[model samples]
Target chain A: MIKLLPRYILSFILLVFLQVFILNNIQFSGYINPYIYVLFILVLPFETPKWFLLFIAFVLGLTVDLFSNTPGMHSSATVFMAFLRPYVLKVISPRDGYESETLPQLKHYGSAWFIRYSAILIFAHHLFLFYIEVFRLSEFFATLARVILSSLFTIILVLISQYFYRRDIKR
Target chain B: MRSLLNFLVRIHFLLLFILIEVFSISLLVNRNSFHKARFVNFTRQVAGNVFVKSNNLKQYLSLTEENQRLAEENNRLLNIIESTYKSDEIFFRSVNDTIFNQRYQYTSAKIINNSINKKHNFITLNKGSEQGLRPEMAVVSEGSIVGVIKGVSNNYSTVISLLNLDLKISSKIKKNGYFGPLMWEGQGYQSAILNEIPLNADIQVGDTIITSGFSSIYPEGILIGFISDFTEKGGSFYEIKVNLSTDFKSLDNVNVIGNLLQTEKLNIEKQAEQND
Candidate 1:
């Protein structure tokens, strides 16, 4: 646990930096803005306490909100994602269930399970995020398109990142 | 009491989730209201500092474009001065310092951050109360109106941009004086919708739209846009499309307009309302 603490802290800083400095600047057309910051919560250890997970998620979302100037949009969406994380894990758990010390990574879960897990949470996060952002139902279909496109973009980026990290962990 | 404590322990995580969500929703809803003034002001200041630092690094890349714009503005000003001199001596002499009471004063500021994609777009300016800026002051770019000051802190301020759906500017045709309210339809940044112009108004595709000066925020005759197209709305009013004069994407420098008589004018209007 002590050894893992520093690694988590380092990745947290790297993820936030990448999000605010790079990803936030990339607007693929006007409708799609990929949000990869939620990956921080998605990759947490399966046995982590629920209260701790929620707290970390809130802080992460608030930090992103502060930098992006969106106030509560990111935080609200992130909390919703965190709240649904345990149930998602339960629904997709393997025959013997997840190990206590292992984090949810592509290597341990394989490609199929990992993809389904990420898709469910990412879709939920993006759906909540884009709706809260527009704050109106008048442009429902337009906002829905944004949510779908942005979720796909973010999932692709997350999967590619997982591949690289998986190799590093193997080495 | 023991059972209550046990139940509380059982639902602790759910309770925590609800509490955090409630806090976030409150923050989101109170963003545009007076209740969160202090919170928004603090966030703006912190975010403003970071953007100013980043803008300093990035602004160097756009130096050439900025210089070209400044040069063009200078030429336009010189042409206006020379035309005034040739047209009327009385009007030219009225430009003298003692003759003019200077109802509007301008403070120059640079835009550190701006957004065009959102429905309610806002621009962040570098100047704030330290530079005598306040809420409701008019902000203009080189030759066109940009927005009005919506909030101000000590070192930075936020302008509700002209592209915002919430902003409606009173505008009129410069040729025939048929006035209407101009608003953004939350589509592209280049065009906006002008409504309430009667069908009989002789408006053309290329007629200029200038400020009506009905509101105390902006002065009369500031250029807004030009008529691009018009169609009758329900056979009574004209639903005209306007091509905005100010290009918001490349905008940088702006001048905040401070009206000296705003307080007095608002006071008199309030008194008249009481009598009515």
Candidate 2:
């Protein structure tokens, strides 16, 4: 736990920087605003206590909100994702139960398993976040399109980063 | 009592989750409320400075484009000065110094953070109260209307962007002077709707739209956009589409217009209404 502190802290800072300075400015049209910052909540250790997970997710969402000027919006969506994270892990657990002493990562699970896990969470987060931002049901289909496109991009970005992390472990 | 304690303990995590979500949603709903004002200042102090550093790094990449825009504006001003100087018969009589009361003061500021894709978009400018900025000032790009100042901190301020659905600018047709209120429909950044133009007005596609100066904020004759399309589907007015002139994505430097006479205008109007 002590050794994992620096890793989580470093990723948190790096992801926030990447989000505000780069991905935010790259919002393609009004359709695809990819949010890869939610990756932090996606890859937390499976054994993380539920209450602690909710707190950390709230803090993470508020951090992104501070930069983007969308107060409360991101935090709510992220907390929702954090709340559902355990159920998602349980539902997708393999037949052999699970590998001992392993964090949720592509190295422990193959690319296929990791992709499925992250995709479900990312889809849920984006769907919830966009709807809340829109609030009104008038542009339902338009908001849905934004959700699908943004989720696709976010999933692709998450996979790319996971593969890169996997390569670093090989060294 | 033992059974109730067990139930409460069993659902503790769920209770915590609900509590956190309720707090967040309250924050969202009360975003523009007074309680969030102080929190917004905190956001301005931290996030605003970080944006300044990043904007400084990004500005270098667009130096040439920025210089070209500045040069073109200078050239246009110079041409106007030269033409007026050559054509007018000026009287060089000495006048009282008290006659030169300045009505408008312009403060040039750099945009540090801006969002064009959101329903309620905001722009963060580098200058703030220390730089002689106040809320309710109009902001404009090179020669186009951008947004209005919303909140000001010590060294940073936020702007309600023209793309925001909550803002409405008084505008008129440059060709025939048919005035209306221009508003964003939250559809796209490049377009807005100008409504309340009388149906009998001689309107055409591509006619220019300019500010009407009905309010104390924006001055008249500043170009808002060109009329892109219009329809009479509603009541007695034409719902005209306008292609906004300012490209919100590329806004870098803008001028904050301080209308010094706004207080005077409002006071007099209030006095006149009192007699009625």
Candidate 3:
């Protein structure tokens, strides 16, 4: 756990920088804003304490919000994602269950489980984020399109990054 | 007591989650209040710096188009100046020059960041309180009305763009003087809806719309849009669609308008209401 602390801190800074500087600027047809910062929470070890997970998620989201100038939208969405992460893990747990010290990485869990896990959480995050940002039910379908397109883009980016850049998770 | 303590410990994670979520939502709801001003300003400064830096790198690619727009504006200004001088000379011979007062002043600013896709879109300007900008000033581009100032920090201000669903402008037909309230429908960037124009008013597909100046935010006769189509909603009013004159997607330079007589007008109206 002590050894992983520095790694998590480093990735948090790197992801926030990439998101604020690069991804926020990439408006592909004004619908897709790939939020790769959620990858920080997605890849945490399965046994990470729930309280710690929520705290980290809040900080990560608040940092992004400070950069994007949307006060609470990102933080609300990310906290909700963190709250749902454990239930999602429970639902998708294998017959043997997850290894205690293993991180939920694409390399560790294989493609299928990782895809399912990331897709569900990313969809939830995007839906919440878009709704909170818009804050209206009148444009429901338009906001939904934004959610789906952004979620798809974010998931693909997360997958591509995981596959190409292999990082060792100490067990 | 022991059993209650154990239960609380067991559900501590859930309690913490709820606490954090509630805090975030409260922050969202309190966004426009004065207490959130410091946080909003801090974020604005950070985002403003980043956008200004990135826009510097990207601005060169659109330099030619921007120059063309500026040159056209210069020509228009020259024409207005010459016409004004000619009229002034004619009026001076006929009557005294006491009828005109400078009611509005303009400050130019660059749009560092803008969005047209969201339901409540906002544009960030490089000007702020230091430039004498207030919360309700009108923002306009060379061609048409842009938006109204929503908030201001020290070095930057955010404008609620005309594309937002929350903003509605009083507009009128240019030819026949029939007027209505114009609002965005949140679908396309180019078109907006003008509501409550009477069905019997002389209107057409190609008629022009301009600011009515009924609201003090915008001055009179600024070009807003041209009527594209219309339909009768029930029996009395026409739902008119207008293609906006300013292309919000390519907005760069804008002017924030300061109405010199707004406070005086508002004060008089308030006094009248008090008497009534």
Candidate 4:
């Protein structure tokens, strides 16, 4: 528990820096801007206590929000994803209420399950994040387009990270 | 009792998530006019440091073009300066005369980060509060207007770019002074729509547009853009498309005007509001 905590913290910090400094600079014609920061919440260990998960997700998102100057969009989106996570897991249960020792990964849940899980979470996060950021439906089509494009970019990046790092779960 | 305790513990996260989301949502809804200037300034400082390194790298590759442009500007200024001193002294006495004072003041800044492709665009400048920058100050480039300052920190501030949908600047026709509000239509980055101009106004293709000076932010007569096309919408107002003077997609260095009278005007207005 002690070792895993420090490792996750280190990676989380690195990811946020990479996100704000590097990925934030990448805007492909406004539509395909990816926000891979939320992957921190998506890949948390399954055995993580519910309260701890919520707290960590809030802190993670709030930290990014503070830096991006979006104030609260990321936190709101992240918490919404965290809230819906359990339901999503239940809907796509891996044969049973995940083994206590097992963590969510492409290897454990299969690529199809991972896709469904990540897609739903990413969609929910993007939808809420975009709507809140704009704060109105007046430009509904434009906002929807942004959400779809950003979600695709974020999902692809998250999947890439998951694919490469899935085997390194020491805990 | 143990099962009930476990159930309660399980739903605790759900409750916590909802609470945090509510707090964040309230923040989002109330962001405008929330006086988060200090917070934004701090964040911009952090972002500015990161961008400075990258902007330095970018400047290296574009050095030749920048030098050429700078040389041309230097030559033009030198010619004007030399001619002013020689033939007629009183005719061209001080460069800081009424003509120079009436139109604008320029302070160059590097565009560390800019967002042109978003529905609501914003640009970050390297110059900030430490450089006499303040909220509502106008920013422009050599040939075109860029945006107005929304917030300023000790070393950086965010400009609400002309491409932002929410931005509305007072503008008028250079030929006739038919004033209207210039706003983005959530479309192209290079173009914006000037609305509320009377249908009777003679707006020809390529008619010059400049700031109306009705708003305190920008001085009247600063070059904004040119009319690309115009069409009467609903037989009432002419919706004229303006090709922006500043190419936001390629923006690098910009000039931020430090309006000396801004705070005085704001204070007077605030006092009047209090009295009323």
Candidate topping lDDT: 2
Please name the candidate that would achieve the greatest TM-score relative to the true structure: 2
lDDT agreement of model 2 with the native: 0.87
TM-score of 2: 0.90
The segments of candidate 3 whose C-alpha lies over 4 angstroms from its true place after superposition are A167-171, B34-36, B74-100
| Alpha-carbon lDDT, every model | 0.87, 0.87, 0.87, 0.80
lDDT of 1 by residue, B18-111 (tens): 9999999887777667323687688789889988987887799888987988899899989988887787776756677435677888889999
- Considering summed lDDT, which 10 consecutive residues are worst modelled in model 4 chain A? A64-73
Candidate DockQ scores, in order = 0.56, 0.66, 0.56, 0.53
**Residue-by-residue lDDT tens digits, candidate 4, B146-174:** 99888877887888888876689999999
Q: Which stretches of candidate 2 lie over 4 Å from their true place?
A: B34-36, B80-101, B264-276
Better of 1 and 2 by DockQ: 2
Could you tell me every candidate's TM-score relative to the true structure? 0.89, 0.90, 0.89, 0.87
Model 1 misplaced regions, further than 4 Å: A167-171, B34-36, B74-100, B232-236
Better candidate number, 2 or 4, judged by TM-score: 2
Each model's RMSD to truth, in Å?
A: 2.9, 3.0, 3.1, 3.5
Candidate achieving the largest DockQ = 2
Per-candidate iRMS values, in order, are 2.3, 1.5, 2.3, 2.5
